[model samples]
Target: MSSSQLPVRAAGNLRSDAGRNRAEIVSAARAVFTEAGTDVPTSRIARRAGVAVATLYRRFPTREALVEAAFADQHADCSRFFSVVEQHPEPWPALRTALRRFCAEQARDKGFTAHLLAACLQGRAPAGAAATSALEAERLTALVRRARDSGAMRPDVGLTELHLLVAGNAGVVAASPPDQAAAASRRFVELFLRSLEVPRRSGAGDGVR
Candidate 1:
């Protein structure tokens, strides 16, 4: 190869290798965080990724960076759920589905639960991460407003109340043993939904009590 061409090819190879390492580190972080919590040492993730600690550090820089990158999939899933909620014509069912699905997912993934709870507690997230979270919050607020306007939900509820609901659900997921977490979260969400709903006009109760 010509000298110029050789340098270009070398640069391309380095880029490819960097991409591969980033992907592996993210994949390994997901598995490691799932098996353990987010607080586990970064060396474990580097070990799982089959990379040197310095390599992992070069890619992620910090634990939160790795956690944020590892959680991109779950973040997308949450956005999808919000989109579904936004599209549904029936507000109550949409709200119910969103809560149930989100909480259930949280229960099933302790790593996600830890990530979410930590984000909530910290009150600030990395810029891109914070943007997605803010968009989710805004979408949920709109949904809740629509539900309230439809008289399907209590009129007094707002984003603050929804935040509390989510926090409580996260707590349930955090407290339950892994095997039982899903069921417990489901039950809690069901009860919470029932409490939030407006009663039917027919005076025939829907067994919420």
Candidate 2:
């Protein structure tokens, strides 16, 4: 190959290697965070990625940057989920589905649950994460309002109650064994949904109370 072409090929190979290293690092970060929480050491993550610490640092300069990159897809998925839920024609059913999915996610990934809950409740997450949580919260509040207005949800139900339900489900999942966590979360979702639903009357004279 000509000298000029050699330099171009070498640059292309470098770019390819860099991209592969970045992907591996992000993948390793996700696995480590899921297993041991996000506070696990960067050196461990680098080892898991099969890369040097300096390589990981070059790709992600800060712990927060690494965490954010690791969960970028998760945040995107969450936003998409809420957007889809918002479009469902039936407010109550959509909200129920949303709760089930949310609780299931909490059961599946401890690190993700920590990040999302911290972002939503404490506003201590990276900027993108915080923004995603805030948007989802607003979507949920709108869904609750719609459900209540349509007499599908209890009149007293609101965003606070929903947040409490999520927190309670998170607690249940955290306490249960790994094999039982999904079941526990599902049960919690069912109970919370039942409590939030408006009572049905058997006859015209029957009162909801």
TM-score of each: 0.77, 0.81
Encode model 1's per-residue lDDT on 159-192: one tens digit a residue: 5666677778878877989788778878888888
Q: Which pairs of residues have clashing backbones in candidate 2?
A: none
Best by the TM-score measure: 2
Q: Which pairs of residues collide in candidate 1? A: none
List per-prediction Cα lDDT, in the order shown.
0.76, 0.82
lDDT of 2 at 110: 68
* Model 2 residue 67 distance off true place after TM-score fit, in angstroms: 2.3
Give per-residue lDDT, candidate 1, residue 163. Answer: 64
lDDT of 2 by residue, 22-66 (tens): 999999999998887787889999999999999999999888789
Stretches of candidate 1 exceeding 4 Å from the true structure:
1-13, 113-128, 174-177, 203-209
